[model samples]
Structure formats: structure tokens, C-alpha cells
Target chain A: MLITNEVPDGAGHEDPGHPERPDRLIAVREGLEDLALGDELVTVGLRSATRLELLRVHQGAYLDELGAFCYEGGGDIDEDTYATYDSWPLAQLAAGAGLAVVDELARRGDGVGFVAVRPPGHHALPDRAMGFCLLNNVAVTAAALRSAGERVLVLDWDVHHGNGTQSIFWNDPDVLYVSCHQWPLFPGSGVPSEIGGLAALDRIVNLPLPAGATGDVVARAFEEVAGPVIDEFAPTWVLVSAGFDGHRDDPMADFALSSGDFAHLATWAAGLAPAPGRLAVFLEGGYDLAALRHSVRATLSAVLGDPSANEAPTNGGPGSDQIGRTLRERASTLTLVTAQRDAEEAS
Target chain B: MSIYPRTIAVGFDGSPDAVSACAWAMATGRRLEAHLVLVHARGLLDRFDRRDPRALFGDVVSELATRHAFNEARLSWHVADGDACSVLLRCAEAPVFADLVVVGSRGRDEHAGMLIGSTSLQLAERSAIPVVIVPSTTSEYHEP
Candidate 1:
């Protein structure tokens, strides 16, 4: 099943020469159209996320300031991020799209939910905007689910570290955060050594890959490393910080992945869900319009086990060594983390 | 037990207020006999572009050397690829482990009316260390 946004495109939020503009949503729609599901496709739109829902992930003071800033005519939040008169409302709508997908999937009890919304959210922190994200959409859904007592695994394969998502769930034992992105890149936080907080040691599995790393390396990291931790955690729900920027064609960061790689990744994520209805994907980033279109088609199609256009997963690239490196780091970090937890327990 | 500011993280982005902050940081670093870490966050746009992002760092250091006769050993600069606030915050962690953070009230591309830039506000709100938002008019405080 496919879930879409109720709000209009981010026209008011556009900045000339900016990469994260309004046309991204159009590309996503085109990918969906190519599927040709006809009656089989379930197109759903959700209401704007409530103030209470937003407050769960964002600071009240920040919400007030951001809303005021936008209404008063927004400008660049940083060197890259921008906002405008319609941004606050559009952000609320984008966040709501995720909640809407989760709500509908829970009600149906059987379909893989995908929400394609702009103002892509993984990079947004609880109190501030970073990268191009204004608010944490995936976090809002994950938080709401956590409140209802669900164990969540936030699978972020965005090519850039989802620093905001990782920061929000760092100390929470219930949410397992996994990220696979290019190392030494923007907002550089994810490293093999950043195991979760003291209370939630090993809760985070950070797999930082080198440039030109192929889809085969990514799959190995997921299935071999994150796979076991996920199984042990036994998450009741899975929320993907799905970004197509990793495709070789995108200019954002270096990771030589293809549409076929995304399909395989989606299939792996689909199997992690405790139930078919417990999985959902939220858009984050993808700069190249054509790559975004193809990657989206392959990913959404894979989730439903449907036939769609795809490319061969690339291989024989760098970063194969990263998997072993991650394991060694995890083993060493666990020693220190376990001690920290033990010391706290004693106190 | 906490020196609080034995090491100061100063943000510079080639803006007017950024210069003011750096001047203030130089004098402050000299007075307290502290180490000053000049941090510049290279955003995604900068990362994609091939231009050198740290050109301004040398100019500022030259100015400091002329005025304060600043000891180069007491200062260092870093260009981490990220947003302004995040790079400084990360520098405060393992290697640098800065005890204090500082930034200008506004940055290069901020609106003219904004009293404080997003970088300064975010640093003030998020930094684990104490933050000092140096205004553009921060008189180059020398040993007085």
C-alpha cells in the first residue's frame, strides 16, 4: 500500500539553485505511477500531525520559534536548509504522512506502508534543523509507536548519517538505531565506535562505509552485522529512513548502489517486521531526480513482492573491509559499555 | 575540579560578527592562558563544491598575529564537514574536548534583521559547554 502527503508541494519553501526543492515530490510520484498497480494500489493521504504529536519529538520552545520564524517569512536555517511561509505547515503535513501510514497499516494488519513526502526528515534534530530537514518525521512516528509499547528498529540507509534520529534514540533501550552511510561526510557523527548510551549499550549499530562501496558490502553489513542484533532485539515494528541518494548517479555522497541494491535492502527490511503491517518507509534524501525515480520504484516494489524495473547490484568495490572493522569495534565497545552499565547498576 | 573553559571552541565563517568573535577569543585565550580551537563547519554545499573552505582562517590568524602577537602554539583551526553547530560540538568531544564554545551572533547568509544566527542559537541551546555569543560590535578586547 502507498501513502502520500495531503499538503501541496513546497513551492513557498523553494530557494533558487537549492537541491532540495519541490520537484523531488514529482519524481517520487512518477516512480509510483510506473508501478501501474491500478486497483491493487492503495493511495492514502493523512491529516497534519497534531501539535501533541509534534511536541513528542520537538521542543515546545523550538516549535513556537520555528512556527513564528516561518510565518514571519522564513529564510535559510543554515548554509543548506531553508524555510518559508508554508514550510511550518508543510513540515507538519510531511510528518503526518508517516503517522498516517503507520495508523493505516495497523488498521489493515497486512500491507507494507510507504509514505513519500518532502522536507525529508532524518537529519532534523529534536530542537534544531540540520542538513535540509526541518523536523524529525521518522522520529515522530517511532516515538508515538514506542509510547504504545512497541520495540522499534530505525533502519537508516540514507548515505548520510541520520544524526538527528541517532541522537533522539541514543539512550532509549526500546528503539534500536541502525545507520549505513558514507564515513567522514556531512554532520559526521556515525562511526563504528558510537555504540548507544550507557543505558542502551549496543542499541546503535553504525556501519560507516568508504566511498564507492557497492551494494554487496551494504547487504553484507545489514544481513551479517545489523541482522543478528535486530533479531535479538525482536522489534515489533520497523521504520526505514529510506534515502535514494546512495545511488551511484546521485551527487550527495559516494556509495555505488543501484536500484537492485535498494530492492534487496527493502526486502531485507521487510523481513525484519514482526508482522507484514508493522513496516513503514519515510523519504529522507535523493538529489538526482532520475536516480531517485528508479530507486523509489525498485524499493517500493520489493516491499510488496511485485515485479518492477531494476538494475544489477554493483560489486567488487571498496568497503568490504568495513564489515569486519565494525564487528571488531563492536566487540571492543561492548567491553567498555558493559562495564559502564555494570558500574551504574552497582550505584 | 572542572576548569570549565581551559579550552575554547571559537566558530568563524568569514562574517563580520565572526571576526569579532575571533578577536574576542584571541584576547580571552591570552588572558586565561587557554587553548583556542578555531572551528569551521563545512556544510553539504561546501562539501560538494571544490573550493577551499578554510581560506578565511589564515586571514584571521594573520590579523591576530599582527595585533596580539598571538602564540600560534596556543591556537588551532579545524574544518569539519557539517553544519556550524554540529562541527563545533563534535570537536568538543574526543580529540579536542573543548571546555567552552563561542560563536558570532549572526553568520554569512542569515537575514539582516536576525539578531542571532541559527548557528549561534543552536550552539547556545545545544552545546554541552558554556557558550558566548559574540556580537558584531564586540570591541577587540585586549589585555586592559
Candidate 2:
């Protein structure tokens, strides 16, 4: 059972030339269309993210400012991020999509919850909007889960780091943030050195891969690095920041993953959940239309136990050396971090 | 005894407004003998010239450098892949920790009539340190 909310990918939140456009949503729908799930896919109308839910990961003032900005006929939030009059409402729906899916998944108790919402939220901060994100949707959901006493594990596989997610969950001991992203890319925060906040040491796992890394390298990073971290963390719920831009054809960042690779990732993520219905996936990045469709198709199908062989899994790529180096250096990094924390506390 | 603003960050986008901003920041840097960190946000989708922004700006930035002659060591360039506001804020906080941040009132994107660019305004509101927005009408600023 694949559970998700059906929200209109509104035109109210769009910039003409920006890659994070309305058509990206259409591409996702087309991907699902290709799947032909036929009654296996359950779609529900999205409820607007309540202020209480949003306040979990975002500040009250920033939300008010964003709402006011949208009401005033929003323009460019930054060079790459933009908002129009309908953006605030649409963003609310997007943020709410995850919460709705989580609840539906809980009630049904048997399906993977995948949300393909607009203005992807992993890049959004507590009080600031960055990287075309209006609100931290995944963070919001994680915080709610943590509040309900469930240990949450956020797996960010976007081509770019989910800097905002890391920052928000940095201090929480119950929530672990793991990211595998292309290094030297936008927002620039997913280095191994950024282990986690003092309280949550070793909780943040940063797998900064090279540009053309294949699924093989990523799998090793997971099996060797993230696997141990996830095992020790033993999270009750798993959330994925599922950005498909690592696809070879995506123009944004360079990663050689194909649709088949997405199938591998989704299958791996499903295994991380405590149970069958405990995993949820949210859209983060992926600009190329064709690539987005194929990747999404493969990911959802694989998660639903029907693997899409439309694209073949790739191997013999780069970044294996980097993973070995990370494994070697992790101990020293933790020792140094612990010493710094001690010195600060002693002072 | 604050002695604040010992370092300043300036946003550069190779636009005319950015040129004016550079001129103003350089002038202020001269008065205070402060470090000038020129920041350019290379968006992920940005295929904008990867070469030094100064190289892209050509004679205009060259002219600004010649006019506001300061120690070469005092000026550093940072081309980061991020949002303009986020990158500038990061420069002011860690690694750079600039005491002040400055940018043009508008960049290439803004409509000509707007009072201030969105990036400038957002930075001003969020930055812990002071921020300066150089107007397009600004000519080269000089201090006695």
C-alpha cells in the first residue's frame, strides 16, 4: 500500500526560468502514470499545515513574514528562490503533505508514504528561507514524531545537502540526520566534520560523495558508514529527503545515479523503517523532467515491491576512496570534537 | 570602544549595481583599513562564468580597484554555490565573521523602480551585524 496526499501543484508559486517549477510536479505525476499502480496508489486531499505543526521546525516570526510577503505579491526571495501570491498557501499544503501521509500511514499500518510536494523543504531554516524552500517540511514531520516519543531518522539523499534539516535537528538526541550529497555544491554544509551538535554527537552522518559517484559507492557508504549509525540509533520512524537530481541527466549537480539506482535507494530505505508502514519519502530536488519521471517511477515502484527495470543500476564510478578515508578518520574526528566540547564546558 | 566593522562583506553579481556597491565598499574599507570580502553566490543551476567575477566584470572592477587602491592582501574573493542572502550571512558568521555586510539596493533581477532588492532587505533584517545597501544612484563614495 503506497499512501500519499493529492495536492494541486499550483502555479501560484513559480518563477519563469527557475528549475523548481510547476512542470516538475507534472513530471512526477507522469512517472506515476507510467507505473500504472491501479488502485495500489492511495491519494488524499492535503490539509494546510497548521501553525502549531509549522512552529515545530520554523519560527513564528519567519512564518508571519513569509505569509505577509506572499500577500504582498511576492517576488524574488533570492536569486534562485521566488514566491507569488499563492505561494504561502501552496507552501502550507506542501508542508502539511508529510504530516497527512504520516497519519494515513499510521492508520493503515502497511504502506510507504511518499510525498511529491512543491517548494521542497529540506533547505528551509528555522527563521530564514533559502534554496527555494519556504518551510522545512521533513523537519516539521520529524519534530512532531519526536514529540510523540518516536526516535526519528532523517535520510537526505538529495544531490545537495539538507543544511536546514541538519541545523534544526542538530541538538536533538532522539533525531538522527544522515545525508549523502555531492560535495562543493550549493549551501555547502554536509562535510564529515559537521558530525552533529554537542548533545547529539555522531548522530549526523555526512556522506559527501564526488561528482560522478555511482550507486555502488553510495551503497558502500550506507552499508559501512550509515548502516552502523542507523543500527545504533534504532529509530522508530524513518523519513527520506528524496531528491532525484543526482540522476546523470540532471543539470544541477553531477552524480551518475540512474532510475535503477533510485530503486536501490528506496529498497534500502524501506528496510530502515521499524516496520512496513514506518517509512515516508518527500521530494527535495531533481530538475530534469525526463530524469525526474524515470527516477521517481523506479523509486516508488521499488518501495511498493514492484521494481522498475526501465533503467539499469550503474557501478564502477568514483568516491570509493573518499568513503575509505572517512572510515579511517572518523575516530580522530570524534576524539577532537569531544575534546573541544570538554574544553568549552570546562571554561 | 566598540571598534565595530573591522571587516565588511560586499555582494557582487557583475551587474552595474554590484559595481557601484563594490566602489562604495572599497571606499569604506579604505577609511577603516578593514578587510573586504567580496562574495558572489553561484547558484546550483548557475552556469554563470566560473572564472573570477572580477575577470567577468573586466574593466569596471579593474577601474574600481585602481581608484580605491588598498593592500592586495586586504581584499579576498569568495565564489560560493548558494543563495545570495544565505552565503552573505554565512560569511559574516563563521570563517569570515565580517563585522558588517554591504550590497547594492538592487541586482540585475529587480525592477528598476524598487526601493531595495530582496536580498539586501532580507540580509538587513536577519544579520546580527549592521548592513549597508548602496543605491544605484550612488556615485563613488569618498570619505575625508
Clashing pairs in 1: none
Best model per TM-score:
1
Error of 1 at B51 (Å): 4.1
Predicted model with the maximum lDDT: 2
lDDT by residue (tens digit), candidate 1, A19-128: 88889888888888888768656767656888899888888877887888899989877787888899999889888888888888888887887888879898888777
DockQ score for model 2: 0.33
Locate the minimum summed-lDDT window of 10 residues in model 1 chain A.
A1-10
- Quality class of the docking in candidate 2, CAPRI style: acceptable
**What does candidate 2's lDDT look like per residue over A104-180, in tens digits?**
98888889998989999998988777778889989989998899999999999999999999989988999999999
Give the TM-score comparing model 2 with the true structure, all chains together.
Answer: 0.87
**Interface RMSD over true interface Cα atoms for each candidate:** 2.2, 3.9
